[model samples]
Target: MSLTKITDKAGLHRHLEAAMQLEHATIPPYLNALYSIKPGTNTEAFHILRAVAVEEMLHLTLAGNILNAVGGTPDMTVPGFVPLYPAYLPDGETDFQVDCQAFSRAAIETFLKIERPAQGATPGVDTIHKGRKRAHHNGHKRHGTALRARHVPGNEEEHFYSIGEFYQAIEEGLERLHAEMGDALFSGDPARQIGPEYYYSAGGGLMAVTDLASAKAAIRLISEQGEGVTDNIFDYEGEIAHYYRFEQLLLGRYYQKGDARGRPTGREVAVDWDAVFPIKANARIADFPEGSALRQGAEEFNRAYGDFLSLLTRAFQGEPALFVEAVGGMFQLKELYYQIMRQPLGDGTHAAPTYEIPHG
Candidate 1:
């Protein structure tokens, strides 16, 4: 539980990589649930999940921009970047389980937990508390914090327990580095920045980062849209944060401008749980029988998912225009996933996309 004290550029780069992974981790599970809903039914839930998933992509792009601004390459094609099913989220941190499954109450609860704010935790203002002291891998003894090497795998001891804390650490590190290096800290190519033209429907527009202020603004947008500011339910863009959106489904009600927290007094919302296709929880590619049509379709969906990731990696690498292609890939995935959901498995259930990366 010792906080990883990021002190240099290499440390920041590694943490940003973790950030990118963290953002990408939420998409598959969210997509699994979103695609499971019956078309024309649960429209509210569908829109909510779809919006959040798209914003998660925005968060990923923002993290990549930060890395690029610091002269670090954002490599999404790395091995283990696309985690296996029932994956632990916010990689290198807590053991919050996320799974690929159809839409259900359990799925919504999982989404709520993923987007929930860090309870009683203040970002950028509190000293990260360490649960225990441990020796650094380099045989150096540090007090009150842990020092870990950048980009080294299996270094779970160096991560923050919550996404907010992780970004807070990055913010602190950026401030320190900017003070030390000034304009040199943002030494990456300006042409590599991805702007609003490359991304749309991500709630707030994507901002390209060329300096410390822009970088901080991008990070803040990510945090606020996911967890909200302090205890408020709305982000700066007047949109409800992901946590509150899930809460609405749980409460079966929506929130208005004057509604109190925990008591959404807006319009009533209905969720038709029975309308969802009964996609098995944590469904895998192996679950479908071999040589079956379901298996073939699921495998094809996984391959497309892998292709989408490759395109996203290229977009982050240098070609921002590739984002349009990646977005189109997402639509193609939706079609495949829905087609799979429509197929029957000879049981009381239907086929569901396994969400595995075939080429990962």
Candidate 2:
């Protein structure tokens, strides 16, 4: 099999748009698990989920900046921008499906798979390995990597072995296109850039991409934060990369400074496995009775989520400060998540945010 490559300016835009979707894709699952945890229990898991979700938002913003830097429009309102639950990621992993579910061992396991690094594959390195096939999970046949840009027109299919390699391809494309097109490559309006002042999250601050160097920095931060390059556990800043942070939950310990890779020798990480509200996996609003309050709550959450994305769309378009309003909307959705999760599904499970962006 030949390695996937980005060969032109339009092709690079498609990949960056896919990167935005890829970053935003992880948020719902993380939020579902984070909100489903009973208020006080699983504090460690709670912190990890919350932090990772916030970082994903940052990643999405950074991708938007890079897209805008390269004269490409970033549109979150595009059809199929929000993925259905239990869907495969744009990162080309066929081993597991990400679902909107509660915080549990199973959810964390999926999170690990989402953030899993491709060993021996660094950014700018070819990731195609010959003759290696993964057994399909849940009896689903491997149909190769799914193209996230099916909703977008005039773009060819692209796939990567991991998120890091995906961003690396974008970075390399930026380099190639910059050399070929010169200043014309970064022809985007500077007004669309979202600086650090407009965003603040626990994971880290945002970077504004203006040139190839800044664009590469933004992509590097997104990839390294998701999965540290090579075999390293910590990112460049000495902070634990997201993969290791999630792994800490599975290993039942925190990673401390000077700890060797794969062996977190810090204090025990406490987890109350039973403290979570067992919401239905891959839940849809249809799961609730049409006239039921649970159904209304799920729909309301989806509507609010849609509105939040709209706010984000405007923020990315020109009004970067709209992020403040979007942050407020997130808190509102948090309350709605709690209201829904508190209601019983009558099957020993509870309701979760369906994340279905209601269309006109």
Model 1 Cα lDDT, one tens digit per residue, 93-163: 44346777788888888887677676464334333334232323434322211112333343335545456
lDDT of 2 by residue, 1-360 (tens): 112356678777878887888888898889988988899888888888888898998899899999999888898876578888787776555456787888888888888778877646334434543222232323764331233433333433344557776777788888898889887888888888999887765578788888888898888888888885566787778878888899899889999988876689999999888898889988888899989877887888888888888889998889988988888888888899899888888999988888778866
lDDT of each: 0.77, 0.79
RMSD of each: 5.5, 4.0
Worst 10 residues of 1 by lDDT: 140-149
On a 0 to 1 TM-score scale, where does candidate 2 land against the true structure? Answer: 0.90
Candidate of highest lDDT: 2
The regions of model 2 sitting more than 4 angstroms off are 1-4, 121-157
Candidate 1 stretches with Cα past 4 Å from truth are 1-3, 91-95, 121-129, 132-156
Give Cα distance to truth, residue 334, candidate 1, Å.
0.9
